[model samples]
Target: MSSSFQANLDEDYIPQNILLTGGAGFIGSHVAILLAKKYPHYNIVVYDKLDYCSCLDNLDEISRLKNFKFVKGDISSPDLVSYVMAEEHIDTIMHFAAQTHVDNSFGNSFNFTQSNIMGTHVLLEAAKCHRGMRRFIHVSTDEVYGEGETFETEAMNEEHVLEPTNPYAATKAGAEFLVKSYHRSFKLPCVITRGNNVYGPHQFPEKLIPKFTNQLLRGRPVTLHGDGSNTRNFLYVEDVARAFEVILHKAKPGMILNIGGANEVSNLEVAKKLITILGKEDQMDELISFVPDRKFNDLRYTINSGKLHQLGWKEEMSWEEGLKTTVEWFTKYSGRFGNIEDALVAHPRIGFAPGSSVSNEH
Candidate 1:
């Protein structure tokens, strides 16, 4: 918006050295591996605090690549982030590090605020001061838009107002405010993307899909919040990774796009589907247990992803294919994070300090 703009929107964005925060986590790791392997000439630096939900094993595919490097640190640490920026000569930043569990956020809203809002501020400040910074791609969630009316008719777009319904979503909205301010004031090139629920391999079982699959695999009751009428558009993790890859090269500065998915399913439907996929359809009635809902559970979250589709990114994984692959992966590798019994429960109100992570989790 100003003459001091750091990037030229007219030209293709070229990132020689990139920083991917939370790159060891589920979705972030997929993006990290894809970028590291796809862009051989680009240096991919992963900076993460290795929180309870993340594992270094997620990045094994790219660990041996010469262009890939890993750094363990918190984004809220100004000194460490600055050090990495200087050492890596980072020109682009894809911010994905944040405390993302809604249930956990209820018990630990302060941690969510610190990691999602304050930590994002620290990265924004670092990017602003770095002269080589060309672009800042912020990875956000569809929850920021709160609950949508319906997938068939009431899908929200990038222009919709943000009304986050939970502590986790609220903190994400707070971070978006800071990103927008940096873009308008300092002209630090920034683009934001709000993505749907992601399900695939390596996802911690705290979320719905993987959690249900694992519960069924272990012969435990699949837990559902409330009557299970809540609906969410599910995108396979790799499809989401491809969306980022598209945005990384094609998105213009100051643009905000919604990466919605076509596979919209209700919580009840998902639980039943997982049961059938896991060969427990006979016990579907007994395996699914309704639990108390969250402090506030949005009924549905549907967003219009036409903008991202226009950028050459579209959902490729069918629901049948994605769900089957996810169930199979966890059936064999359910111990990826060791015993995940804690994460299989309906609601785990995890308690952790602001800007700090716990050593143990589900």
Candidate 2:
């Protein structure tokens, strides 16, 4: 498939049954809804494990759509995956279900390996067996590139070497290799997408943006890790979803693409901006504190999405605009966020060990 054809899929030119593995999660849910709304004729099935981070509420708007279907299952369950693929006549598989939290991965590296790496193997096997399956798009992250000096220079491209610093990123990088190997050795049609830090509505409070928003709204201090110098490129969830849509139709077998907002910000700067946006500038001094950083924390991650851009796609949202909108949404839905006490209790920063336990507070 050429990028031109993929770009036109939005017009319902190439109709195919699509399977979204983590359709109930933040980015997946948004992508599912976009497909349902734009290509109403195509079948859109959501296969999710309904993990704590995934909420059905995220799919509330599209659940009633005629072309939408929801299946509660784990990607690691080959039997379930095979059953769904056969029954749904799935042609394209969007693999997004995995243990995503870096901090959580530290504490339980086994879970990360099982879900991110092993689960992908199961999915690849199923895709290979399914008769009509044409493409498998593996959603990945920029962290796979690990710490680098290129963050401030040209964005890291597909040619960058894989050096995942955390268990979560390592698992994702492993999954990418598996996909590439399957495509090369077995001739499985697959494309890998490395996206930047995504934030927006429906995101679990464990992530940085949402967590900080929730804490500030509740008058709690937002913890900053290691002097807040670590920088990350933030992309809105919707933009990331759109990139998937673009790649699903356009990318050829064995292709890898990078997607990012092209905007980078440090943790300290982000916290200060959020505090100002929320009109709590006076509390900034007390609300932000630098704690020990994660183990082997990658000081920077930035992706050069020139490949995707050359394919005729670019991020449509800016961080400043995206952040304000995100803050507004979290504030509007403050009631739904509930309390962060449990999240804090479940994963504490005590012992100050990096790479020891994956922090739920992304």
Candidate 3:
């Protein structure tokens, strides 16, 4: 169906139609669903490339909504990007499309640069051409700040200098610079968000939480890297979505905000928490297997969200509660993760399904 939110000749401004890139991925999907439900009058167009980490099923709930539409396309293509902005009558842009896996980036830095840096540049150029756009929300990660020695006592804020250690983080930092440059040179109204590690439903199982949980369910050892002391703040995906909503509506042009969860837990603690939530505490010691760490694993990641909190945004769920909910989701969907067809659909890049015959070294 055609979008009903068209600009009226008598109105001074056009109705908002948000173009949400990477809406098939974890955080983007959650934010897309929230936007559809919260803004019924505004059109929410989801643009995703459907990479191995992304699934259209993530948007199944909101796909049928009158205000929601999905377009399968890549942001790396300027023609497609420009066409989408025009066809969707997009007035707002949420650029979340990026290759985010650090380990994968080490092996394939070109892919990271293609999607994260070049794609972001293409999208920003497209956004620059759009007239009267309300705001362009650039979604970024705390990893862009890399690691800090003072993470134990201090948190990285918006002013933290970029010192990316990995290729993935470097590309993201480059993208953020491009966003700022567009805002400066083209006067494109824009804002940026640096969020902490987010966990929730529909997350691909390759990440730490889901990977360990899947290993436990399959009676396999949960691989712990470097004695598992690396710490990270875990923000629930729904909370991240809510923060995006607040930033989209209330943020000033050119503002750089950090969206973070106050929960600072270590990698080993996260595994133990999952075991406790899954009632597999008896196998705790046996379930964990210490492995060689990543070539350059950051000791910890902590970020200050004071600016976001000042905008009336705060995390509603504790990390424990969120972990329980996430574990339950995996339990309900365990059969699918075990099935070949479903696993292939979820992880197309891997030669074998997650829990299948192939071993997951990472």
Candidate 4:
């Protein structure tokens, strides 16, 4: 399996051995569990650097499964990445390793580029060397598409151009270009996916949803940026997992698909909904605070997921149901990450560039 792809794999392509980089993170962990449980015959190897936000505990469900294996390594290392591919006899790779936090990217732009852009390069190069590689699924974010109106139709399909405004988005876009180049030049059988915000159980509590839920549970005020008018399309992590499953099964090489949700809610609307669900109506005034906005926050990120839907992928969880379940889970397993007081702050990111003390508190 360490050689190039078989000539006749279009009609019937089944993944026998798969590698999931950053497989211990939120979305990746869910995908790992689903694939391992549904396809017991497929070998699932999770490669992660165990970033502060990523926890091995997230993979507890499938850790003991015969088909599931864990490997500790960094995607930036070409030797280690190549070794894992060769050892596992990996044929398909779902590259999910990247610096995802937008806020953190402002302060730690170099790390993002190193991980999101350079790390992807290592994987692509490794896949190229191992001709047995079948599929290279690159996970990207909707923010690469920049702002969209709440009412704007996301039916543009795959023709929309990338207009990343922030450091994180830019790095993701750069990674996509590498993926595209590899696919066109080497016929690497790459599949790219840009997805909206995802929230659910076992989240790191740094994003809006989990952060707010954690703060509210602790009887602390939740901070909002600007006037809280920024709108984001949110998909439950489980639903997002289903989209990956469909993509792995049906998508072809050189294809780019968008994974978004119908529930387009604004920042203010999300906070209000959480307050209502948590019975904090009377404390709304005291529990909600406004902070400065990001240097260049995208107002919206709506993308046409019709292509993914055509592949028989549809969101099955209601927004309210997902939110309530998320809140309840946080309540039950409070302090899951332990001492996340800093992570639950207004802006926990610090500028890592030379001579900089703090990043913008947006």
The whole-model lDDT of each prediction reads 0.84, 0.78, 0.78, 0.83
Q: Which parts of model 3 are misplaced by more than 4 Å?
A: 1-15, 151-153, 335-362
Error of 3 at 187 (Å): 0.6
**CA lDDT of 279 in candidate 3?**
86
Error of 3 at 176 (Å): 0.6
lDDT of 2 by residue, 1-362 (tens): 12122333334225389989878888888889999999898899999887767778889998899999999888888899999999999999888887777766677678778888888999999999899888888888888888776555566788888888888899888988899888888888888888888899888777788878887887878878788888887888888878877787667767788887777889889989999999988877998977777776677877778778766677888788999999999888765635555443224444422221111112
Cα displacement (Å) at residue 340, model 1: 1.9
Identify the candidate with maximal TM-score: 1
Clashing pairs in 1: none
| Reference-based lDDT, residue 335, model 1 | 84
TM-score of each: 0.94, 0.91, 0.89, 0.93
Q: Output the lDDT of residue 263, model 2.
A: 71
- Top-lDDT structure, candidate number: 1
> What tens digits encode model 3's per-residue C-alpha lDDT throughout 6-39?
2222423233899988888888889899989988
Q: 232-273 in candidate 4: lDDT tens per residue?
A: 888999999899998898877767888988998889999989
- Model 1, residue 138: what's the lDDT? 86
Ranking by lDDT: 1, 4, 2, 3
Candidate 1 lDDT by residue in tens digits, 154-247:
7888888899988889988899999999999999999988888888987888888888888888888888999999888898989888988988
